[model samples]
Target: MKRQHVIGMFDSGVGGLTVMKEILEQIPELRIIYLGDTARVPYGNRSKEELIDFGEEIITFLISQGAEAVVVACNTSSANALPDLKKSFDIPLIGTIEPGARLAVSKTSGGKIGLIATEATVRSKAYSSAISRVLSKGVLPEDQGLRESWQQGEQSIALVKSQACPLFVPLVEAGLSKTPEARGIARTYLSGFDTAGVDALILGCTHYPFLAPVIRDILGEQTALIDPAQAMVDELKSVLDKLDEVQEMKAKSTVKETWKLRFYVSGDPELFQSVGNTLLPGLIQEVRQVIWGD
Candidate 1:
C-alpha cells in the first residue's frame, strides 16, 4: 500500500484489457501488470476445476512480478475461481460480478436487469446471485424506495434474465467485433433482451465492451448498457483509498509519479498485440510472452 503500488490483473485473453483501460484512466499513478491467457482463450466452455487451476497459476505469476493487489478481470474466473483464489492469496483480490450487479440494480427503474456473458459465467449464475444479494441488502441509494416499501411489509423483487453468448470472445479476439458478421451474431444472442424489456443490461464479459456499439444498436436507446469494469475500477479506487499506508503517503508531500503499464500473454504476443492495439489503440506499447510448465 504505497503511493505507487502494483496491481495485477488477469483474464483468459485480451478481453481483460478493457478492464485495464479503465484502471489506467482512473488510477494512472499505480503500476499495472496485466496477464492474458491467450493460449487458452475463451474460457466459456472450460470446467470449474480447470479454471481454478488456471487462476492459481496466473495469480502466482502476477505475484512474482511484485503485484500488491490483484483483479480477476475475467467473469468466468471470477465466477468460478475467486473464492479459492482469495483463500490462497493474501492480497486484496477484487472481481467484476458484484460491482456490475450493483450498478445494474441501481440503474434499473423497472427492476428487470438483463445480463450477457460467456457460457461459463451464465452457467454459474453469478450475476443473478449478486443482483439478488444487492436487492436484498438495499445498499444502493436507488434501492432506498424499495427498502422503505419492504419495511412497510411490501415485497420487493427484482428479476434477472441472462443469456450466454459463447462466441463473443472469439469474435472480439479475431478482430471481428465491428464487422457485420459480429452484428448478426449479436442480434441473435441479444434478441431475448427485447422481450425481457430490461431497463439495464450488464455487459458481463470483459470482452463484450468491444461489441457495445453493436449491442447498443440492437437493444436501442431504451436499455442502458452497464460496463462492470467501470464499477470495478471505482471499487478498486475505494479499496486503495482506505489503505493506511497509501493515506500516509498521500499526506506526505511530493510522492514521485511512478507508474508503468506492462502486458504479458501466455499465448502468441504478436496476436495479442494485434487484437489489443485494435481494441484499445495507442494503449498497448509492448507485449511480452510468458510460458507455463506443461
Candidate 2:
C-alpha cells in the first residue's frame, strides 16, 4: 500500500481514541482517519444485528475516505461484528480481542487471568477463546511460553474469570474518571479479580483505561494490567512492516513522511472535540461528520 492511503479506525465513542493514541505514537508516519459513532454510542447494549450493520456502515465510510486498513477499536464491536466486518471489506482489519488476550497470556506470572470489559465483550468470550485457541495451536503454549511461570498444572492456563462493568463507560464519558461513584463501581467490579488471584488483568474495554488509576489501586501493583490498545498498535506495525517490504520488492516503495490525523463523529463535532482533545493531548484537526450511507 502507498503511504498516501489512510488507516481507518472506529469505535462506539471516544474510547477508541485510546487505541488511536497508541497507533499515532508508535506509527507517526501513518495517516489516520477515525470515526466515533457518538450519535449511537455505547454499542455494548446493542443487538448483534445492529452492531454488524453499524460496523459495515462505518467500514464503508472509511473506505470512501481512502483508507487502506481498518481497526475495530471497540471491544464490543470487535467481539460481535469483526468477522463480518472483515468479510465485508477487502482491506486488512484488526480487532482488540486477540491482541488483548495475547498480552494477558504473556504477562501473567500465574495461570490465572482476569478480563474486565463491557457486557457485550464479556458475553462474547472473545478474550478467553482467543487465548485458548492460541495456546492450543502451540504458537504460544501455555506450559512453556511467555507465561510459563504462571502455569500451575496440566491445564496450564486456567479458567479466565471475566466481569462485566457496564457502568464504567458511561462514567468515563461523563468526565467522572476520578469520582467516588466511579471508584465504588470499579472496586465492586474488580474486587473479583483480586479474589480470583489473577496475576494479570486485561482491560478489555478501551474506555476502561480512563479508570486505570482506580483499577490499579484496587488490583494492586503486582497484578499486571494489559491494555489491548498498545498490543493492537504493535500488531499494526508488524503488518505495516510487511507491507513496506512487499512494496519495496515490487519497486513501488514510497517513503512515509509526516502523517495526518482526521476525526469524524456521527454526533455534534463540538462535543467530540471537547472529549477527544482531553483524551488525546495533541491538537486534533479535520473534524467533520460521518453520515451513514452517504
Candidate 3:
C-alpha cells in the first residue's frame, strides 16, 4: 500500500500516457510504473484470445514490479480482456470503456450518440453495452430486444451508430494529428457518423483524443466530443479512496520514499523516449527496453 510502490499502467503503445498524466495531476504523491507494448504497437487488430493472453503477461510484469493497482489503458484490451484479467488479479483493475460510456450518456441531450474507436473495440461492443445497461429500465416485454440490441437493451440506452477507424492510432502515433493527411482520414472516417445525425461523439480509443482538433473540425463545433481520460481518472480516485480507507483500518500506510516512474517497451527504447517523455511530462525520467514474451 506504499504510495511509492507504484501504480502500474499498460497500453499497446503511447496512448495510456494520457491516462497517466491525469492520474499524476490528481494523485501527485503516488509513484507510477508505465509499460508500453511498443513492439506490438497496436492491439486493435489482434484476436480476443491473444489480447487476453497479452494482457495477462503485462499484468504479471507489473505485479512483479510491486504495482499497487493497474490501469489497463488500451481500449482494445479493456473491451476484450479486462473481465478475464480482473479475475486473475487481486489488485483492483480499471478500464476505459465504462467511464467513456458514462461521459457519453451524461453529455448527450438528444440521446443520439456516436462512437469512434479501434476495430477491436467497436467489434466488442463494449461502449454500446455500457450505455444500454444504463438506459435499459422501463422496457415493455414485447419491445425488449426490438428497441435496441440486447447489450444496449440491458442498459436501456441506444446509440445512433458506431464506427471503427483502425488507422487512427497509427496516424496519431506518426504525429499526424494536425496534418493534411490526418484531416483527410478524419473526413473519411467521420462522414458516416456525421450524416447519421448523432448529437455527440465518444472518442472511444485513448489515442483518438490526440487527434481531437481535426476530429472536431470534421464533426463540426456543435457536436459534443467526450474524452474518457477525465472520467477514468475520476473513477480511479473513487476506487483508490475506498482502498485507502480499508488500508487505513489495517494500518497499511503508504511509504514515503521519493516516488519514481519507470518506463519499459518491447521495442527500441530510444524510439519511444522523446514521444513518451512529451506525453507523460514530468512523470517519466528514463525508458528501458525489455524483451517481451520472455
Candidate 4:
C-alpha cells in the first residue's frame, strides 16, 4: 500500500475510537494510526485558538509519522479547527461535520432536523452551516425529503433545532451511559427534539453513540438517528477512490497482511485500554504513551 492510503486520526480522547471502529469495519483494508490527547481529556470547553494549536500539533505529529491523510475524529476539533487545519496542511484533511450534515439533510422528512452535541459544537454552528450549504444546493420534492427552495440567489433551509448535550460525554467516559441517571439526563436534554417532531436527529458528538438506546427510546422509534462516523468513513472511502488509493475490499481477517492499526495516547495506556475494551474488545491491548512533544 502507498503512504497515501494510511490515515492518521486524532481526538481529545477515546471518543474518536467510535469513528475508528466505523473506519475499521467499513474500510478494513485501510491502514490507520490513531492518537488520543488524553491528558487534555476534554476539548469541549477550549477556545478556538487553543483547538487550532492543538490540532496543528496533532496534524504535524501524524504527518511526521508518514500519514498522508489526516482525519479529525473529535467533533469539537472538527467544528473549531478543521478550516484552519485544511489551510495549513498539504494533505487532504477531513472532518466529521459536513458529511453528517449532508446525511441529516437528506434524511429529514419533516424538514426539521435536531442536533445533539457538546456546548462547543453547538456554539460553533459547524453542523448548522454545513446543513445550510447542502440545502442550498437546490429545491426538491417531498419524496426528496426537504421542503426547501432556492430563490433570489439564496437557498432556504429546513428548521434546525440544536441542543448542547454537554453532560453526555462525561457520562459516557464514566461508563454510565446505560444507567437510570443517564436516561433521566437524556430525557431532559432530548425532549425538545421530540416536541419539535424532528424526523432525523444528528449525534453530533463522537461520544454520543454510547447513549443511542436512551436517545432512541426518548425520541421514539420513528426518528432517524444519524451518526457522523459512518458518513465520515464513507467520505474517506470516496476520497480514497478519487485518489486511486483503495485497491479492493476483502474480509477483515483476510486483509490483515496489508491493514494495520496503531494507537497512541498522552495519558495512562492502562486507562485507555480498560475503557476501550468495553468499546472494542482486543483493540486496545497495546497503546504507546505519546508525550506532548514526542
Candidate 5:
C-alpha cells in the first residue's frame, strides 16, 4: 500500500526554485519536496568532497521524508555528487547536466554553445563532456567514418565554451537580478560568445535563470539562452511518464490527494520563503528549517 513516489529536489539556495517552479507548473498533481542548503548558499567554489558530503546529507533527509525519486537541481551537486548518489540510492534520480546538454545540442544549428555556471561546474567540464556525447550522434557516415573520427577526437563538432560567473549566485540571493551590477557582470562574462558565434548559451547554474533578462539583453534575441531548470523538468516529465506506464498498478500522487509543495532550507527560512514567494506565488507561503548533524 505504498503511495506514489514523491519527487525530492535540492540546491545550494533559492536558485533551485526555478526547477521547482517548472515541476509545480508541469506536474501539479505530483507531490514535491525541496531542500535548499542556504546556510552554504554558494556551492560553486566548494571542493568536490564537500559537495558530496552536503549532497548526501540533503538527499538522505529527503529520502527519510518519503522521497522516491531525487533531483539534484544544483549544477555543482550534479557535477560532483550525482554518480555517488546514484550508487548509494536505489530510487530513480536525475541531474541537470545531461538534460541541458541535450537541449542545447538540439537547438543549436552552428553547434557553438556557451555555458555560464559556478567555478566548480566550469572547472569540472561537466557540460563539455555532456555536449560531446550529444554531438557524437548524427555524424555523417561518409565523412571519414563519422563515429570513429568523432570518438577518436578528429571531428570538429560542437564547441561548448564555459565561463564561471562566480558572483551571480550571491547577486541572485540578494535579489539583485535586475540591478545594473548584474548587467555589467553579464556583459563582461558574455561578450566573448558574440564573437564566438554561439547559437545557444546554457545558464548552467540554477541561480542564473533569475538573471535571464540581463543575460538575454547581452546575448540578443539570436542567441538562445538555455535554462537548465526548464530542460531538467521537461526530461523529468518524460521520465515520470515512462514510469507511470510501467507501474500502472502502483498508487500514484493524483489531483485528489492533499499534496502540497514542501520547502526546507538550511539557512534562514524567512529569507528563502520570501524569495520563493516571488518566484511561485502562494505555493511557498511557509518554509521549514533544516539543522545539520542532529
Candidate 6:
C-alpha cells in the first residue's frame, strides 16, 4: 500500500520535455509530473528576482501535488533561481548546470567547450562558473606548472565560451526547428563557436536540442554537442537510489510496471500538447491546464 515515487519537473515552456524524454528512456519506473509555465514562456529576459519568484510558485505547487523531488529544467531558472530554491525546499532540488558542466568537461578533447543558452543564463555566468568548478577538481599540482606552457590564450584546464540564443525557445515552441529561418538564426548565434574552435558544445538550454540539426550544420560535424538531459537523468537515478520511497517501490514487481505521467501547463494546454507531441511524437497524452493562484 506504499505510494508511488513522483519526481516533478518544470520549464518555461516545452523545453523540459527533452529532459523528461531522457528520464523516461533511462528510468521508466518512476512516476513523473511535468509542468510547463508557458504563460510565462521565454524566461530568458526576466530578472533573477522574477525567476526566483516563479520557481518558488511552481515548485510549491508541484510539491503539493505529490512531488518528492524536483528538477529545474529551464537553464535560465537553473542559473538564476536554483540555489535559492534549493535552500527553500525540503526535498532534493536538481538543476541542469552542474551535471552539464561535468559532462561537457569530460567530452572536450582540447579542454575547450562552448555553451549556447538563454540571455538570463548567459548573463548569470552559471555555466562558466560551473565549468571552472568541474575542471578545478581534476587539476593536479603538476598541471599548475603546465599552465605556463599553454598557448597565449588557452588554459591548462577547460575553457568555456557561452553565447545566449534568445530566439531558440520561440523557434522550437512554434515548431520551426527545421526551417530555413531556424538555420539562419542558428548561424547568426553560433558563428563565434566556429572561430572559437570548441571541440565540445553544451546545449545549455533544454530547448536548443530541438534545433540540433541547424546547430550541427553551422558548427560542422567535428564539434561534439553535449545534451545535459542525459547527465541530469544519470544524476536523478543516483538520487532515486537513495530515497526510501523509491527503494520500497522498487521492491514490488507490480509497482515497477505501473509508473504514470501527468502534464500540466499554465498556458494553453492545446498548444503545449501539440508542440510536446511534435518534440516527443505521441508520447504526450491528456495535458491539463492549470492557472496560477488556482
Across 199-240, the per-residue lDDT of candidate 1 in tens digits comes to 789998999999999999999998989999988998888777
What's the TM for model 2?
A: 0.90
- What lDDT does the true structure give each of the candidates? 0.86, 0.81, 0.79, 0.80, 0.81, 0.85
| Candidate 6 TM-score versus the reference | 0.89
Q: List, residue by residue over 222-293, the lDDT tens digit for candidate 3.
A: 898988888888877777777777777988765576646788888777767766655445555678887875
> Could you tell me the C-alpha RMSD of candidate 4 in Å?
4.6
Residue-wise lDDT of candidate 4 within 1-294, one digit each (tens)? 332367899988778888998988878777788998888877888899999999998889999886868889988899998998889988888898988887787666766778888888989988888887766664242433244333333444454688888788778766677899999999999877867778889898888887888988888889989899987987888777755633444322322344388888888888877777776678876789988864
Winning candidate number (TM-score): 1
Top candidate, metric lDDT: 1
Per-residue lDDT of model 5, residues 1-294, tens digit only = 223447899999988888888887777767889999999879999999899889889888999997878899999889888888888888778899988887776666555778889999999998888887766654222234544555577655465578889999998888888899999988998878888878788889988988988888888899888887777887777777766766676554454457577889999999888877765567686789989985
What is the Å distance of residue 227 in model 1 from its true position?
0.8
Residues 114-179 of candidate 2: C-alpha lDDT, one tens digit per residue: 888888888888788998876665434333553444343444674468999989888877677788
By summed lDDT, which 10 consecutive residues of candidate 4 come out lowest?
246-255
TM-score of candidate 4 relative to the true fold: 0.88
Q: Which lDDT value does model 6 have at 93?
A: 90
Off by over 4 Å in 2: 1-5, 139-155, 249-259
Q: Identify the runs in model 4 with alpha carbons over 4 angstroms from their true place.
A: 1-4, 138-142, 145-159, 245-259
